[model samples]
Target: MKYIFFVLCWWLAGTLSAQQLKGRVLEAGKDGNVGLPGANVYWLGIPGGVATDVDGNFAIEKRPNGRLIISFVGYASDTLEIGEKDHYIEVVLKAGHQLDEAKVFKRGQTTIMNTKSPVIEQVITGEELCKAACCNLGESFTTNASVDVSYADAVTGAKQIQLLGLNGKYVQMMTENMPNFRGVSVLYGLNYVPGPWMSAISVSKGVGSVTNGYEAIAGQISVDYKKPQGSEKFYVNLYGSDEEMFEFNMNGSIHLNDKWSTALLVHGDWMEKEHSMHHNGFLDMPKKAQYNLMNRWAYKTDAWFVQFGGKFLDENRLGGQKGFREEMRHQIGEGNLYGISINTRRYEGFLKVGYLMPQYENTSMALLVNYTDHDQESYYGGYEYDARQRSLFMNYIYQSIFGNNPNQKFSAGASFNYDNYDEIFGDYKRTENGLVKNTPVNPQREERVGGVFFQYTGTFWTKLTLMAGLRYDYHNLAGGFVTPRFHIAYMPDEMTTLKFSGGKGRRYAAVLAENAYLLASGRSVNVAGQLLSGRPGALKNLDMEEAWNFGVLLNRKFLLFDRLLNINLDYYRTDFSHQVVADNETRPGMINFYNLDGDSYSNCYQVEIRYELIPRFDIMGAYRYNDARITYSAPEGLRRVRTPLQSRYKGLINLSYYTNMKKWQFDFTTQFNGPGRLPGGNQQFESFQLMNAQVTKFFRKWSIYAGCENIGDFTQKHPIIAADAPWSVDFDASRIWGPIHGRKFYVGLRFGFDRD
Candidate 1:
């Protein structure tokens, strides 16, 4: 009966309908009435609405009340009641004196939109970022159900994310629409971005448009930093946790004039001590320090806008046995007390320039250029690896409409990518005869690609939207390939949307470097199958992975008891034509790398709901199921296997509450992590639950927050295998499935001065 009732509610939500009206706003003048820009237009009681473009035009859906409101600075506000016969109307605003502002309250800080977008995209605002101790990008997704973040390895404390049961590397990472964080930086790049510096985050799932690239097999994540012109004058965040972590971040803006502005962001963090809470003889977490700095400048005019920025990062990490000291780090091959050390430095710069066409307000041309230099040196026990990466990227895009119809538009772009990697690495294993030797397999390669793409988008009466895109790319090693993508969105009513997407993606694999953590164990690396020859200098001898992704989603929003409710259901499937499988199931102490000989696929299904139960209280819940598998070649022919450490089922619940005046805020989140088959012995781990809570008190210019993570204190009894024999061949740390450490508490403070 409960399930039937839930289905009935969903059916009713889709049946609600509304009328959409389009219009323009102009300023009253003595000479003539001119279009007014930057006007706020919306329904009387709705939370979301469109803002006027440069031409001062708006389109909005209206309820039965048929009331519309328009307001702007230095202009008198106007309210219009539309009759059944009237559909489109134009209004002129007159200059008038304004009174004092009125106090306002909001139910939610995070908003998800599905009005016209063919692909599922959600924007996480800075206000939502404050729900937790979000010191870095990896920690920022604690409250989001779409993405799952977890520790990559038990020893290094490195974090990785998953989308639709796929690894984070399959998701393209971008900054302000420019490609960033690729190649050698994929393992640790998620920690380089400080949360306080971000203005918003855009997460898009499924096959995206070819305008971005051909690498997005799972999704795309784009980070937008606070703009120099519209950001606060000064901001500071200080954070500390009971786990011996401390962090500080500060940013300030400087305006050269009305047309030019710049902002400087600085960050520093450190974990001062090593804690072995589990008594496993290994440190629970790595002790590390990181320093980051960035400077961004923006120039805006009526005809053009340009932004340029540069960033620098330096980080060091150390971990291993509890007794290992820094002085013994040099004794890599002869150490009884194992230790891990890593040092990294990265420098990046980017420029974005856009020009608006004189006659058309919605047409523009944009060019983006980015460069990065990254270097790393690390040692795990007896293994030593060093690498450097140099990359340059350039892209050009042109956006325009078909004739004068805004609903029909297209974007064409060309891009160039270059990456050079130089690496020196060796793995060592202890023998029964009391000897340790380095293993063979080291690669230094370079890759270059050039591509062009065109995308066409069409919208019909705010009811349907379609996007088609195609791109052709030429790789130095993989030869040439073409990728095609398509997306369609249909709205049956004002509250419901149905979307579908399909596309192909390809990527060059860096097997050894990407799986470097496995080298820390006793596992011996082996390569099988026919290797591509004559390309040792360039994109190594591995088969490039190609896959096709298909997705379907349904989303709806409705009003219940004068509060808003949102529900979403989605399913995604990925089939690989060619893939590199890192097999660790055949043997206990062996890791094999080879191209797939059979089939590889993943299917994911998810359902999510968000409801505003009271005036300032919101509840969000989600459930997900994943089936990911691959075929491996074994001594006994071929067999299908479950991908190690991939969860099959998961559930989440998040609650948020705030006071009437927004002075006090509280949030709680609980997650259920289902079991997964482990590598080596194919062990099936038990399911577990995790809980988190936070409280915040806000002042005029400052706010303080305190939070606790893993509040239930649930932890894996033995995350590491053979903890007592770290030097033995039976030791393996790559089979971790759950948290290594227990409950942790943190507190932080944020202070800022608004430019207004």
Candidate 2:
């Protein structure tokens, strides 16, 4: 037929050079049915714009001038100026569903990309920790072998984080994903989250598929800060270390004209530090000052969208008798010992809203809200502690799939949470020969908790992806618990892949900041006493410490010469038949928390490797293992014991090199710790502990670093006083583990600015 009449004359000569505009994507003062999916339609410099199809109808063959633009993602992005003729447009997208920040696709390193997410994700940039000159956020990546930081005992200088070797309180640390630290902010909140306001820090190890909750069993740390449209126009930093700490960090962002934008952050730290009183005669670490302030705001309008932020923190901690003076604990014993003090306060606010509907084509719906206030007061050795808190959170959302194969997709959600708690626990009483009493042994507590959740996300066969979730919680004292989650990822071709993750979680064990050295060695506290209110307790009828953890994972990526190679391994098993596990080796001042006998479990493992080797230069390595135990019940059966500052093997090495004329930089890191199981029964120390390192660098706006930490200053020699029960009553300082202070040489500096 004459070649189909010359292919319809070249498709009508490209539709007469295109020109036609028409729309409906509704949801603004509704009246009848409506829909709004993905919302976004363009013409702000011409070039075809369309992103709304799941029914909210839209058709435009490029022709509708006077700068037209529309946007989405928590709404607010719209523009339309003086149209000469044809026109019809409507947009309103807003719904900040509690949390979701999974979108970073730049793909490079033996490329074979196409994602639908089932979890096996990795992205650690800020130019890859810029060689970890990271002076904040607890030693910035310390050569990150999937994150590890531990040093909790040996007297409060606090530090905790261990993923895959488990028990960093089972991961789940968020900021933009906002559950922002958990419980009592996990002791020190990693030095008040300041690593120059991070621009990226997302690491997931296992069990996090049920809409991001039940509770990640052993992994999840998401932090992304540098907004106002991807900031970086100014920043500054400064630091000093050599046991006499010092720090200062700052940032700024601005743009308040076309649809408004703003950001600001300030940081401070001062250390009149002097570590090493080695506890024996008291005093290990305590002389500090820290502060933080943050602010953010954003706005947009095509339909509507809004954002807001606020934060403030102040802290001071003092260890004990380096020269004692806490008003001298009971004059007669004037040598007066042990000291610790703290004061903390916090406030926060967040919001999100969206509505757009009119049938399907690109349909939409959204809502999210948050609020918080927390306060604290603490002291030790004359005993005094106080705490106050308030919290609230909400979320709701719905997204589309649009017809048969734009790759079928769907999301459903609902959530609500609330909390209130006030507390106090004080102690001091002695007689029978020693004589020191002022009539004190107190406990006054109050609590309220609420929760609800449901979530589902699905996508089939672009290479498989499935996420299922469910959560229901009620705790007045650990009454009800139900959490179920499932995650899956399968792509067996682009090179190779197959992954599966599992989940279930819950926690509460703050009987005095997780055993503050068993009430600083005044002992005598026993729970399972039915969550305690006072009784004949040594663990008298308890419940409210339930746990059931299940996990599995395997990741693999490859490329030999063309660069890019990665391999990851994971295995987790945590099963607890109600637990709190903390004992003091049978009578000796006493200390216990029950619910187990002959066996309780936690077995963790990890292996990692990464190589960029070419572009700028990068190298990575990791190895971790943990097998914690504590199983006892009956007239003295199964007394397992061990699990504190964990270290049964851990190794790491990291290196970085950067360029793009973005200033000079180079970093080197190292870490190694092996040999676990140490708690009272030392025949003169030396059960393994070694940490080594080095650093060199250059940065713009602010940066300077000098290092040598424990340059093999390994410790744990003569772990304090226990020269065979010196002061009788079997002297005990909570069986410390490793690093009682040794090896020191340091230097530091940093500056920050971003959020523009």
Candidate 3:
């Protein structure tokens, strides 16, 4: 049998190489030793534990009569005693509380949750993205409550996100772990990052971790930039807004000695003012300019690690009506107004490598590479969309530990993906009773995939945890597939926890580069079969979407009166089997794309809470619900409804405060939103409330801030559906829902210089 399966894989790699235990977990800052990325390293009666990466490193597996615990979350916990040749270590912790004679620090927790992860992660940080005016990553989830950002039409302002309730292209995004934005950059790619270049973001709800592939299904965000060796040798931010919008950012870092390092980042933003608020002559937002750049490099040693990076971007947009202009977009008849244009260019490069073997014991190996190029050109009034994309990705991993149980672990991988697309869509003019015709459609394609994966994880007695994974892929055009995943977590004490997960995901549906916001609406675009053919691997008759996600989570903590309270609950479900339906409601102008006939689904539910209510004051709350359905094709035929502009429940509340030598800070937020349907599903839309606030002041390195957004200005009075015809067919700017810009205000300034 293949030489007894190669001698049982060489006797399980010689019984997993025997013993191990490596470390790192620092914190003693003032710019000197930071690295505590998700702390928590255990061993006091071991049962598998680890969590540290992003420079805080870790590796575990040697236990023979314990004593090691190290913790985090506001710090102060540590212990060790391991000798017998202690295989590498470094611990450090220490910050805050020590009463009876001084020492009081406290200030951490701007969103974090990771009671030993088995997925169901959270982590937002960088102090919750500075409260507001995050200026990118599409406004960084204002006070986040499990993702949900909007604005997908009402004149080319494109922004979208939603998780568990779907969309955001089934959520996979990623940056530090590679695969980003994907195909034509998913409509503006969430404004192309740049929220001070993030220092954390990590979401992760369900179904993630087949070594990051198979497109997350409805979860997984991961960003975490800001580190070329822990950032800040200089930094700056300046912003302004009141609808005139403006921004600038800068970053810096450089080390070059203890094993190299480098970083550079820059960004610019502009908005050229023009707001039609509810007067609706369109243009409620758009008229933007952007430029971004990045550079990164790193190299570490003591068992090698290297990173490399490159990025560049350019963007411009201009929206319609309000006296359209962008050089009249190829005028041909009488004042050619009604304009909207978008132009974008992007390029990226990446590489990562890691190694650790040194003759093995807790072996390791890693490699990742990425490349992307995206281009877009758009017009929305006479309808024209253009796209281009080229992508490449690769992955390779190998980690070990099994027979000599480091609580059993394994990872094996191989992956490759490549995509090439060029698209163009129609109607340059086309008026019927008035003659003017030109129609186009050019689609091109290329896709390749190759995969292999295997994952396994286990832990037991010290409070469960188990995971399993599998993968197999081959797709020159939808020909092979197999993926499976599972997870489980349990804690049941130490203040509760529980989790469950399930997965399966698949992708390949760039349908006009993800709907290009339905071509800003005077619709007319349909495809029911031959799935866009300009030849070249014509997608073998479409169908490569597939889904399956399942989830459950629960976390708890409570200690009230003396502070400390946290609660969470989660539920998720997604089911599809195949999907690629766009269908703008049976027919209304038009927009159809097909490949699924029966049911589709989504179900989400959430509940959250956090409290600190006394010391530095904090509070949070959340609620969500969605039922999302699908099955369309109706003039009375296949029906199943709901899922049209989404919404059906959401709520939030937030508050924050600080004062006490930390120097003033305050924040507030509110939301309610609920009611939805809109899209020929018999009307339903109304229910609102939104508010925001912020303030800050600090010094030493500098800080100043201010903010406000939608403060009850609620707006949605007419989100474009035909406001006095613009080449009318009932001009439909994609039926948005709520907030078409209203209460504004913003201000900012920050400066830094931390690295020392």
Candidate 4:
């Protein structure tokens, strides 16, 4: 009782003495004052900070001895002392253009750390995207060791990403702070955004902010598109591969006066020829074509900011036996020749509005609205599936400093979501009486959710930060529920930082849509489980999945040989109170779906080390381990088992070198993939090693590069099951555990010019 009373008194005293400071950052150009968007601003010796908005405005809590620090790229950093009476100030930075010849530093390959973020966040800049063949968002993680990407199946050529040994679906994906790639998009949306359209990608592991809703179970990925006002006036990229794949992208920006600007982005890719490497009667990769376009507009002033955008995408793919053609797809039921075809179209529109109070520097409000429509039709062997979805999302958030001091910050928000889905599965078949019938495996749903959330952040002694958040949501199907989350960061010294987080997350399982990749095989689909009350249809009684995530992280940086070295270590665990299990091991020719009856969890640990080996040369190494298990109902009743195809361990090493003035560049990466268990047996796959290398030369306004992927020429012997019998019950294409294609060579060129 005494300890509790003392803690309360201390908190009360600290809350009564805090204050907030607001400011604007600009570049002192010779001709005029230029706002520096995305500038970093923070209080000296503090663990939390904020970035300047598009209009170059910022607000942060202040301390008794508060000192302000502001920094921007290509400019000299500035630090200023704050006075008690100073509530708002304007800072100007001078441009610095000094190049170090001996030690060339590249911004894109560097993993920037956000010291102010309560959760460990890593920022990957657009420059990093140039390091690989980054065709789309799914392929952008090739250089990032934290996220693992693999082929979902050999025939359809679908790629999937995993974080902390969990599927990417558990990771909330966002575009400019608004939700994206949920529901139907979860299937193939990873390929929607072209790499050239992105300015940066932010990755945060563990429980993320509750302001984005409770769908995040593993982590969060936020993508930032190139801004219309700051980027180059025009840019173009052209790429081609030895395997007949070609791509083109163009980006252009226009300024409609000082307060209004617009940007247009376009991308297209096509593989005109299909080729087979192993000659197993199946195409090595599917022939695909896609066209994507986006238009974004921005309007900003001293008090109000607005942004709106729209995107459209169309894609088609075909794959199967080497001789199979699109014309043969209609005869799939006859089974003379196997083929697969898919078509998809998507459209999206979003608007964001922000208001900054002129009288109060610490008060602001923001509203976000988004809408999406997606449709897809696909055929795999004798099976056919079609799905369509329409969704709308809106959120309004208000933020301000409360209490006696600025150290007490609060955020309140309300959100609404509506989704409608229509889907059909199965195929036309002939009955025993020789009558043709259209068999339907239907699963349809309509969901409406409204939620309100509040978050509080507190700082103590400038070295410790705490955040507590709660959200109340009403789902038409799941009913009412509350989610609570907490986070803490402590710095024992200037060199070491420790963080901990725990949170609850819930999401509805779109079982069929998410698992459609499984349809490429001959396995029969089964959906038998306890259903929710008062619900009817093919998907009746399916309960929502919920889980709790907890994690701990440690980061330290030291000086060695007059250079800086950084080490990062983290561990995360996930426990599922309820889960929708996709079971493919209990039966030989069937895929079963049911609710979890027992325990299901995952534990992961990772470590990373980075150091500068020499001037203009850097090396980085990382290792990770994952242990994931689940309980399933078998013929002998419920039993715990290891999740199939989950790697037990992984290792990575990267080396990079740059010549004087960064005119020449070289990069190499090697990775080790550990063994994993296969389905329906205790067998495990053999470990494999992969290597990649690239070289590039830069000119004044143009750059050209060449690279080779899978340099070791290593591939799985047989990626398909029962390859000779495509229509047999044993035929399955979803058991891929390694790369199916060997070495691949590609080249690309980029041209961009800066604007005055």
Q: In model 1, state the lDDT of residue 557.
A: 69
TM for every model, in the order presented, reads: 0.90, 0.29, 0.34, 0.88
TM-score result, candidate 2: 0.29
Alpha-carbon error at 605 in model 3, in Å? 31
Q: Model 4 misses residue 120 by how many Å? A: 2.2
Q: Which ten residues in a row have the lowest lDDT in candidate 1?
A: 530-539
Better structure of 1 and 2 per lDDT: 1
Ranking by lDDT: 1, 4, 3, 2
- CA RMSD per model (angstroms): 4.8, 24.8, 22.8, 6.9
| lDDT for each residue of candidate 4 in 674-693, tens digit (9 for 90 to 100) | 99999887899999999988
> Relative to the unseen true structure, what is the C-alpha lDDT of residue 324 in candidate 1, on a scale of 0 to 100?
83
Instruction: Report, for every candidate in turn, its global Cα lDDT versus the true structure.
Output: 0.81, 0.58, 0.79, 0.80
Clashes of each: 0, 38, 0, 5
